[model samples]
Target: MRLLVAFTCLLAGCLAQKPQPCASPALLTGTFTVVTQNEKLEIYCKYEYDALGQRMRLQQQGTYQTKPFIQDFLLLFREGAMYQIFDTNRTCIKSALKDKFHPMEIPKDATLLGQAVLGSSSAPGQGLLVNTWTGDMSDKTGKYLSVVTEFGCIPVSTSYQTNDYGWEVIHFFNNVVGILDPSQLNPPDFCKDTVMKTDEEPLNFLSLFHNLP
Candidate 1:
């Protein structure tokens, strides 16, 4: 059923948080474009942090048209592990969550859905949407916004709908912080013979790891 409620909310967002505190360098770099729809999809993300906001490299890249078209993907969560590099599914998935933190779990009946001022102009902040979850968008629920800075919240956006299907991002931006070249932090090399996908099976693909929550 909807992939078993999206794998039980990705195992309850990796067993709910525990490893936070590390993510400001202006919340690690920027670049945005969310535009979601059946396929007007935009998503041209970017990130590369390290002094603890952790995320050592993440490059989403997109610009869709329809019928499953995609051309960019890269992620690397380092240390406590996580890596996903789907050059259109050539494959490279891995996972590890030790002392877990920041994977997912904003839905305690999420609701707000309003606020303002996002990023870019000298890093604007104070955005909000508090939460939302219109339910069953294939279990992704939907809508979550968070920007309030002083180096805190930061999430940005999300959306989903079901019936035929839908997705949304609308817009997002972090601005540009730093740290990203240990040769772009591994993963290429034709995805290094693809193996990595862990969770010790029994059902843990998590669709090639979508950066925790």
Candidate 2:
């Protein structure tokens, strides 16, 4: 069955690296949805584990769509994101490794770029892709150094019994040398000043909290 195969991959991904595999036996299964004031989307998933119950891969197919017509998408074992063009059914777009990072907070914003990045909706069949690549690139910088992360779909934590699934990003900046701008780091348009960057004490120099590969 398709569900069985998909779950097997998710299980391998989580358990394959553990010392005593198979100790944790059950798989992680759940549904994920994201609702913006303007749009709604959802994904239903099932996963399988290795002997140690490690997750190996993830398979996600779009279960619902709105405001935008999306063709189906597949999460390859360990690869990239691809979507077909709304205009040309035969045409498909593939993102380079960098574009794969999205839904991320831009920690600093003080800049003047010659471009604009509407939410990922501006493009169809694609996830939330944020762009600050003006190419004009100001003479600015900040910490976290504009990290780039690519995670297919993983639930880091949960609340209210809702299995929060899908990719996540703490911060991301593209093509910046070393500085993070203030305006560029403004809260996401959706958050509207509610979400604040972590200005905590005793920073974890060991990257215990960072999402790095």
Candidate 3:
């Protein structure tokens, strides 16, 4: 009877175990698809992120307002600048980088919602373990939920909503641990003559999309 009780306790403990918080690699490349809650916008992007250098670059192609658009963005947090490049028109807009660099990781205060397997666990070596976490945005105006791989802490998906912006969902995939080309983070040559617009409010990712022509 004692042995049976001990076995049951061990099983229960295993079932209640939680995953530890983990941060993604400092440098990585990935592709993501973004969809807005209103369904008015959908974008597919290939991105390169350098957390250590506080920089990011994105090649974006999307349909907005029933029109197709292509844009490239270079965000340099250290220099406090953001470049929006239109490849088709050879034009660029420079604005201040208002948002701070936020690494891809589970927030320290995030609450773990649950864990699951992405694939069938019945088959050996066929399942990918993942965890979901939720938290309020740092600004307290929004909330976010994210899913990440259990082993490497790679982002799988994230959804966030604010009172002003509604909601946006981003699905990440095909991520690798290192940047293939560091030069990708540099501003395009067309942006060399672009002057920073000091009259307009600084732009974040969502605002950039909403204001797209």
My TM-score estimates for the predictions, one after another, are: 0.25, 0.21, 0.85
- What candidate 2 gets wrong by more than 4 Å, as runs, is 1-29, 38-68, 80-93, 99-213
Write one digit per residue (lDDT tens) for candidate 1, span 134-206: 3333245543343323235444444544233255554446554455354555567877666554646322222
Q: After superposing candidate 1, which stretches have Cα over 4 Å from the reference?
A: 1-23, 26-33, 36-39, 42-63, 74-147, 150-184, 191-213
Choose 1 or 3, whichever is better by TM-score: 3
Per-residue CA lDDT of candidate 3, range 60-158, in tens? 989886689888889998888998878778889899888878898998899999899999899989998899999998778889999999889999999
Q: What is the C-alpha RMSD of each candidate to the true structure, in Å?
A: 19.7, 22.8, 4.1
Per-residue error (Å), model 3, residue 114: 0.9
lDDT of 2: 0.26
lDDT value, residue 39 of candidate 3: 74
* Model 1 vs. true fold: TM: 0.25
What is the Å distance of residue 20 in model 2 from its true position? 20
Sorted on TM-score, highest at the top, how do the candidates line up? 3, 1, 2
**Preferred candidate (lDDT higher): 1 or 2:** 1
lDDT (C-alpha) at residue 188 in model 1: 76
Model 3 clashing residue pairs (backbone): none
What is the lDDT for 40 in model 1? 51
Which residue pairs come into collision in candidate 1? Answer: 22-52, 22-53, 23-53, 29-176, 29-177, 30-175, 30-176, 103-213
